[model samples]
Target: MSSFRLITEYSLWFILPALCVAGAYSWLLYSKKGPWSPLLNKILFSVRFILIFLLCFLLIGPLLQYIKNEFEKPIFVFAIDDSESNTISTGVAKLSALKKEIEQAKKILQQEDYTVDIVTLSGKLSIDDITFKNPSTNLDYLLDKVESNYENRNLAGTILFSDGIYNQGLSPAYKELGFPLYTIGLGDTAAKKDIILKNILYNKLTYQGNSFPIVAEIQNQGFEGKDITVIIKNKGKLLDKKIITFSRNYDLKEVEFRLTSDEKGLQHYEIEVVPLEGEFTDKNNTGHAYIDVIEGKEEILLVASSPHPDIKAIKSVTDQKENYSLNIYIPGITEFKNEKYDLIIFHQIPDLQNTAAEILNKYGKDNSSIWYITGNKVNYASFNQINNALKISQRGQQLDQVTAVYNPDFNKFSLTTEEASVISKYPPVSVPFGEFKPMNNAEVILFQRLGNVQTVKPLLLFSNANDKKVAVFSGEGLWEWRLLEFKETGTTKVFDKLIGNLIQLLSSREEKRKFKVYPINSEFYSSDPVLFETEVYNDIYEKIYGQNINLTVTSEKNEKKHYSYVNTENSRFEIKGLSQGIYKYVASTILNGKKETSEGEFLIKELNIELINGTSDFDLLRTISDKNKGVFLPVTKLSSLPEILKNSSPQSIIHSNEELSEIINLKWVFFLLISLVTLEWFFRKFKGGY
Candidate 1:
């Protein structure tokens, strides 16, 4: 409801003219003495006077002040935890009781005219479904969701029902939610008689017939003087076994197991601990890992005109890998056994002495991939004729000291974040001072940077052209790069990874599929997205779009599901969530009116960090509530929380305002003046005074 009033502060400016016009009109009417009676004359004069006065007074603008009350119900929200730990921490009863309390709270809030929303936090927030089996809890992700949903709103407060057991990311104590937060701690703090398989560690790749050690850690609580047997098995075949004795109530033990890999391809191993008398949560008692065993060693041929430290540096790294057998041959001494090789690395090969061309022709004609490393000794003109991947034109024997700058668009494979950083800081290498031009399609990993100017010239790259895989390193000083890497990081893993990645990319078999569908990451965690990307090329190797591909996923339990995905702008698709298991997929599409199919397998590992420490982190919960102007309510005290909110919400909507402007437009003034003048005219005509 609203009220209106005419603003009369400036009425004095219009009042004088109104009175003068009224009196003048009265005189004009009275001056004309007519046959009408005195009463008629007075009435006529009064009508004319009122009409004239109204016309004069309307010159001043009038305004109406209007106010309205808007009732806005306060928004109240609840985020409930539904992770696997909920069932472990005396939470079954508390969760049941809390559900009842929540129903009661919803009724009270609705009756009090509050907008309520309840969501379940099971590694994510959901309103219609609840799954308490999520393996991990990410409090940071949950809080971020809450902020995104209620920011800039009258979010009176929020209620969180969780066990304070977060295993993934930042704790809740560090968040500034900008509103009141009330937490109800679930789970028990009492230690129980339990045993857990904490973690398993092993190399992800190994060679056939090689023995690799697997390390695992176990934790025991309240199981003193008890012996448990741990067994390692692959495909249900026993590999190794050990018995561990827990001497103390709470103990952590690290054990090692050595097993021989006799098979090829991906292998799965399960490490399990025999349960004691009364352990109920058997999920965490077993750990598993996967290792890929290569069948045989692959030979790599290294050709250089003479002895150099760079060759020694490269040899040291390749010798450590059991899968690659490296052979080095200087031009004058001996010839490399080109009998059967997987890859060949040529260092400054087309020299002014012209000694390395015959060896280059011997191995380069074959289908095996080649890597070219150039330095001051490389003859630029002869090098251009030998390789068609890149062309360069420079001044006579001038050298360029170029540092390595990583290219962000390299997507062939991946380099660790730490390795990229280390390579960027190492000393510069010597390249020809010239204009470098690449004529073929190349995926560059490192670019050349002279001083501070980053250039587009490729310092290290991989290319696939004319049915051959070629990699190029346009400069050298790898020996310096290796020594600097070791001096700084105290290990050559970073450098080895850099070179190893290039070797793997160039040495791997080429893909001949026209219609291809592959996962961005073959190995995924339960916390990560299952992402797939596709590539469909026409006859001439040009990428085409608008392809409809059908896919079927089969789980280890033989459950199969079908899905269809058309390409996005980037030719990608995603399944945002999946359970932990081994999944194989077959993707097929109609290309050129023929069906083409590609199949692959991917693994999703479960993240059980939240279940390791099952005790309640009540201190973290208290810190969150204390800093956010809220109350920390335990499960026993949860009933009193709604009462606190009830007391605080009376001032939820203290006031509101609105606008109404019907009279302020001044249209009513014109209608009132016309009505008075019309009435006077009708009366004059009836009294025969017209």
Candidate 2:
């Protein structure tokens, strides 16, 4: 429905002046005619008057307003599950019949003045597009798409048909849905005889020669007192095997395999359960996992003046990490090698007797990281000589007890709020009474708190001396802090975190290179995208792009595939549709007239989640229907869906829209003005008036 009205900012009285002026002009021009008769003269005068009046009236800039109302029919969505599980129990013929019934129901709804649309897992379906070929099922993703696409529209409800076997996304049960949901159940609901490898648990990373355990769960059904053999393998070589006896019809047994990490890089392991006769599909009997085994661990050296509890405290935290190997040395007591280490700790070393001058001078020149824990026994003269970043001037050999005051502005590393709070309650330790001085390059992690007064003196800080990372702890009794943390929290989490963060920050070094490329991940599923990231830098180590990088992937069968990708600083190169195997890749590029390359290995495994359990779950369908205030039925009752929707009283919505346009801008108005002027001139000429 639509309506039109003429509007103006000025009053209607303004158009009368335009009318008077036109009439006077027309009368003056035609009153004294040469050869025309009075009747013809009057007709010409009237046409001239109307045409002139319209031109003058347009000065007021009148506008034409139109209001339109549109009525939209209620929309109904019929969604179907297009996953492989739908055809597992019901063959293609039966599934095709079900699609016909759904189409008939949609036509009926359309005849009843309702807009109906059919959709599948991917999107809106064509006439013959329901093939049940999608590899996985995600009903939750389908529902989310419907809700987002039809939000605030004339959508009345949705009708879903599925077997309720979703393995990709969150369960669609009990979630708040704006529209009513009606579900049609499919697939066989009876339990079948099958053996499934349900799950596998293992570590994702370990060092070389370390033993790691993998546990696989074998779920048995309808095979009581039957023995099943489980085996694990790597690269087609058997590593271990086990036999499990199921005592009941439905039982779950766990099999464990402990294997040494012999080879470096990404390692793929496959676990399988031997199939038995009369058992359900063997597609779900095998499972796979990958572990990344690194070649070596970082070596840390701990040098001390004497055997103190602080040394034990630091060693206890470092021992928990598998990537760090620690060695303790007393300069005079034991013979030590002057080997290169990742990090060195000096605990009250550089004392009056043993300064460790030879060890410090050698490692210091090598730019190795070092941490200094100072106490009352520290020799200020020798310690201050090591680095001028921090200096202590003793006053008569006095001692002061100081607690920790955390600094929130420290950005070197991160510490949790709970860890900071726990540090505040730690017991104070003895420090030399003196005037403490720290250089401008020092970043203080913790300051000294003297009896409830926070001071500007550094208790724990980090600084760089001649390109070597250095840390200083200005007090003793770290063991006390660890004990207090465990006693209050039943664990040493806070203490361990503080020490771990410190070690990580001081030991880590950035490796900057030019023209490098590697895969983003070492392991991926067949459905997952294979992506590689690249970095091309100039001589000064600034990221540069526009270089062409060539990649070569060699499969286990010696088949090589080559691809060339243009490098972008912010994006990754994506490769698609590679089958299941272990692949070795080499990425090479030329920058600044030099050839550089990087090589790595990755594994692609197949996903069989849909075949793990093929039994139908009608109870899940009913729960979804009831939660959204709708109905659930089997596939046979699909013909009754139109009647149920019609009884629900879906209403049509009317949307009102208003449009305003200037009257002078209308095309018809311009044409009408030209026609009137032309007619008046033609009549005058025919009447013999020039």
Candidate 3:
């Protein structure tokens, strides 16, 4: 409803004078006797008098005020749980019928003058969104969202439809809500006979030739004194087996399997508790685990011309790792084997005699990576000739002491703040006094700090040439660094990390593929999209795009599915709607007239958690309604919700609004003034009163 009125700040007494002034002026003008009839004169006089009086009133600057009030009906929220668990106990046909009935109830509430909004866990407020296909449910999250979305609105209450089985978020029964709750519970509350593999525990990564443990938890219901065999297999090959007897109903047991990992890649294992008669579901009776096994320990060879403390320090750090075997050989004392190793460390080698010439020549051409640490006794000419990364020119056999300065621009590896800080303040090491120069391709990790100034000359650097990694250290006080760190912090962790990172970088092999595609993960759920990542590179190893790659996916039954990658994005390819199974895929692309292909396999496991334990918890729903000051009912009584909400006496809200404007600003007032002036002029001219 709205109303309008005119008001003025000036007093009403000011209007009386304006009225007298207008009447006197109009009577004087029209009282003249110039060629006019008396009747016409009186009529013209009244029009002029009224027009003049209205114009005089404009000086007061009156305002027009308007007030409006709006009434909004109370809103009722109907939230539904759209999860797969709802379809477990309630079949599809019944669920569909129930959904139609809920829609009818919405129409009834709207007819009764109450606003009804239908919402689901997906946040879409449409009846079609209740498909009962969402993988999980969270009742507490739904309640929180409704309260937040309609905080200050005229929300009378909420009507929720759920199965009381939430597996994603906190339980709704324990939460305190702001509005009254009416719950319509669905699903069966009685327990069913089922055998479920509750959980699996194992390491995702381990080394080959090492034994790892796999523990599986099993739960059984209504199967007392029943014997079952739990078997573990890999690619249909049985590795271990165990027998268990359920002592009572609802018995839970754990079976452990210790088996050696013999492969060097991702290994998929299947754990099954043999199904019995009359089971709720066979999907949860079997569990799967994928473990990636890395190749055995890496071999490292340390060669030196004489006994040095640096060799001992390097050996101590490497010895602590089970995946690394370190060997030290002093030229004249222990015989050095020329066998191939993952990494070779030359400590002040290529001395005055250049004794390591044979060893360097042998492994230099092989796949073994090399690291060089120079001391005072190292022959500068021999050192410069061995590695192309760094070159040094000694000045009359002199040695200089220098400290380390970290280079932040280095991208070959990373270091912690504490490690970089402690190493920068370390005691100076002895380096040959000379002109030091590194190649353009060398990546410097540490620069030399000369007394008070830091120089661009590299103290430690690495380079890759012909797919071989080479590192050079220009100083030789590594042992002192370890001791200083241990002295200050009672541990040499900082020192060890610095060395470990360098070794790991040089020892690891670089991938030589110019184009490849692989699965985003080793395992995926049946509901999840099977995604693969694709990468293409030029001859120089820079990223390239706009290439088409074809894929062929083969299932265990020899069924084939073919697809081609779309280059909308440079790195990701997605495939959806695949059932649970093990699949092998091959991706191939042609570049530079050569065919390159990548092959891999992935496992899609079952995620039908709703069928694992189809029992509902209606007691939780009752508790929620009781605590929130409402009533609970089975889904059969859903139509009676409208009557219950009416008893709560939901009232509509009235919102009032007011607006003010000057009367003179009204468009009709301006048009009226023009019309009165025009009429007066026409009548005066026709009657010859001008």
lDDT of 1 by residue, 227-280 (tens): 888999887789899999988867899889998888776777889988788874
- Write down the TM-score for model 2: 0.70
TM-score of each: 0.76, 0.70, 0.71
| lDDT string, candidate 3, 560-604, tens digits | 999987544545888898876678899998878899888988878
**Pairing residues by index, what is the TM-score of model 3?**
0.71
Model 2: residues with Cα > 4 Å off, grouped in runs: 4-66, 87-113, 117-138, 168-170, 301-321, 326-340, 345-359, 370-513, 538-548, 568-571, 590-595, 658-690
- The model with the greater lDDT, 1 or 3, is 3
lDDT at 115, model 3: 95
- Quality of model 3 by C-alpha lDDT: 0.85
Q: Which candidate number maximizes lDDT?
A: 2
Candidate 3: residue pairs that collide? none
Model 1: colliding residue pairs: none
Q: Kindly give the stretch of ten consecutive residues in candidate 2 with the minimal lDDT sum.
A: 122-131
The residue ranges of model 3 lying beyond 4 angstroms of the native Cα positions read: 5-69, 122-125, 297-512, 520-523, 538-544, 556-558, 569-571, 656-690
